[model samples]
Target: MRFLRQSMIGVFLAAVSLGLLVYAAYVVQSAVQARLSDDAPAPPPRERVFAVHLERAEARTITPVMETFGEISSRRTLELRAAVAGRVTALHENFEDAGRVTQGEVLVRIDPSEMQAAVDRLSADLADAEAEIRDARRARDLAGAEQTAAEHQVSLREKAYNRQLDLAGRGVGSTAAVETAELQAAAARATVLARRQDVARAEARVDQAATRLLRQRIALTEARRTLADTAIEAPFSGTLSDTSVVEGRLVSANERLADLIDPNDLEVSFQVSTAQYARLLNPEGGLIDTRVLARLDVAGVDAQATGSLSRVSAGAGDGQTGRRVFARLTHASGFRPGDFVTLEIEEQPLPDVISLPASALGSDSTVLVNGEDNRLEVLAVTLLRRQGDQVLVRGEGLEGRDVVTTRTPLLGPGVSIRVLRQEAVVSAGVPDMLELSEERRARLVAFVKGTEHMPAETKERVLAQLAEREVPAQMVARIESRMGG
Candidate 1:
């Protein structure tokens, strides 16, 4: 009975296993049959079309602009220095930092008391020298008269000696008388010689006096110059900066007192890469006088000035790369020295070139142009110049073709694209207008009207635009972006 029961259980287990195998087979067969019976081929893979902004390439001559940062400075800046050391006794009312001064304006006065006293003393000494000179002349004249009298006496004595000798020879005069007359003549001649020596000494004295007078006059002139130097005067009309002197302050000779800057003689110094610098050069290898515009932002307002390229730095400055350039501004009304400014310099114009967004250029110096059937084709281009965010390129068959402004890695040659924005709609110079839905118009108008930071004139203009049948799409977009919608 136990064997029979075991056999029955085994048979039952086998039967259940067989039934499970059959049900699995049936499920697999039904699935296979269903898939095979559908007989529908898989649809061909569709190409993905990327939406991109496109700009039409139009060949024309365009002057590329190179933008750089620069510093504004004065071409004519003078350091105000004290020419003589003294204590500041007087100060001009406007002799301070940022003071406006005109030509020949006295800015400071060092204590002139000492200089004046020196000058007075020198003048007195000069006067004494002149008086001495006059006295020497009178003495010289008296010595000459004395010499003449002595000479006349000598002549009379000689004549008397000759007469006495003649008398002695003729036996009318004694030998003693002749000898005495001869001795008297000799004594008179000696007196004449002494007078001549006195005359020479007087002439020498006169020369000495003249020399002393000249030296004293020079000293007096120098003292007067020193006195003049005590008063500091402006050499030109300009503005003063960095003033350091004050009333009653002691200053040394050649001490820097302030800086005088000619606001009219303004210049901007900027640096550019070697490649860009080459573009600014003419065929003669000298820097061309390219037109430039300098802009300074002051309190949210732009101060613009026009200028021309002046010269290139003789050497690249220490710890810097590229070429340093200078530009002379024509009219710098609201600019000052050492102000940081923006410079836009016009480069040589490139003919038969198209200015495209920088992103349109590929890493391989190739650009993707729109081909037939909305496909993109890679074309080799020559890069002429780079103007800020744009690049100037020239290539064959690149004109009149739409270029993708913004490129992505997913986009490549032979890929399909959907032009999200056309050249006319996205152009910078033209105004893009479109009819807006009433709801959108109302929302934008409400957002613009509610903006407190917006100026009234701008707000009014925006409202007026919205009221028209067609409104500018850029303005609407800007308004919506501000609305956080």
Candidate 2:
């Protein structure tokens, strides 16, 4: 009975398995038919719109400034040298390095005893020559008078000879008497010739004496000049530098004594690319005398001065490209020669030009402008000048148009755009201010005070600014950058 029951259970199990397989086959066939017969449409992709910052393109006269690195220098720097070799006898109270002096102030006095003695001896020689000239003139006069008397006697002798000849011709005079008169006339003629020779010698002596006197006068003038050279006077009011002379120091002719730097006559020299140089020229092709400003950074302190473009270097330096430019400072307080500085040169006013952020310019010399329906349109523009973070450009149909402040690869012509932010055109002026922590302020103050090259007034001003509640952000950045903090 157990074996029969087990057989019945196995047969039931087999039937159930066959029925499950048949159901699975029917479901797979139905799924295949549905997938082959299905018809569905895909949804179209939506166009992408980019949001960017925009600024209005306004046409206005904007002066572009070219900023470059430079060096501060004095245009009226002079090298003080010893004109004559001698021992320095005395020195000015301020004859030292960094000493202030005035024009015509004697700075050095070389030993003048030798020069003075030379002058005295030349003067005496000149006086002796003058006296000799006077004596020669008197002698010439006496010789002339003697020559005249001799000529008179000759005339008398000739008259006597003529009378004797007349007597002889009448046969009333002896031959010996006529011969004697003839001999006397010949001797008187010889005396006249001798007197004429004396007069010539006297004239020659007078000429020699006059020449000697002229030579002596020239020598005296030279000696006086030498004596004057013993006292070295300042040519202009300025400060002394590189002083190498002192009292009792022996110096040679043309030896450098010091450097006279006209602190008031300050200038700055800088360089610019050829393209930039071309734009700084006037319509006549000459460099325009544009306004400039020089700034020197000493630690955290800045020394600023106003100036004008003066001249350009004739040649580009060796192994250098572009032009070297110079500017004359008007009030260059706290500036010293050889100090590295920054120069801001203002170019000519550009009319009908729009100033835009430098990022707005595209590599293809084009800019993106907002068109109708908030779409971007590429506009060709002429890039006039680049002023630090800004660019001056001009283009047709760009005025009064909304321009993209920055360009991106995703933005192009006919592309839809949304302005995330709009900014009005702002002029570049003074730097923004920032509040500093106590530690930062103290650090900057310490740096400014410790700067050896910084002027006292400049340091005080800088300290005053640091002491305030807020400081110039630019100044802080510069100071921190130099401090490597």
Highest lDDT scorer: 2
lDDT at position 457, candidate 1: 49
The list of candidate 2 runs beyond 4 A from truth reads 1-6, 13-44, 168-172, 299-301, 425-450, 460-485
Question: Tens digit of lDDT per residue, candidate 2, span 1-485?
Answer: 99999999999999999999999999999999999889867788899999989989999998888889999888899999999999999998999999999999999999999999999999999999999999999999999999999999999999998999999999999899899999999999999999999999999999999999999999999999999999999999999999998799999999999999998898889889999899889999888978898887666556889998889999999999999988889878788888888888888888999988899999999999999999999899999888788899999999988889988888899999878767764578877999999988888888777777777777788788889997999889888887788
Q: How far is 119's C-alpha from truth in model 2 (Å)?
A: 2.6
Model 2: lowest-lDDT 10 consecutive positions: 418-427
Task: Give the top-scoring candidate (TM-score).
Answer: 2
Model 1 stretches astray by more than 4 angstroms: 1-40, 45-54, 85-87, 141-196, 249-256, 371-375, 400-402, 416-421, 424-485
- RMSD to the native, candidate 2? 3.8
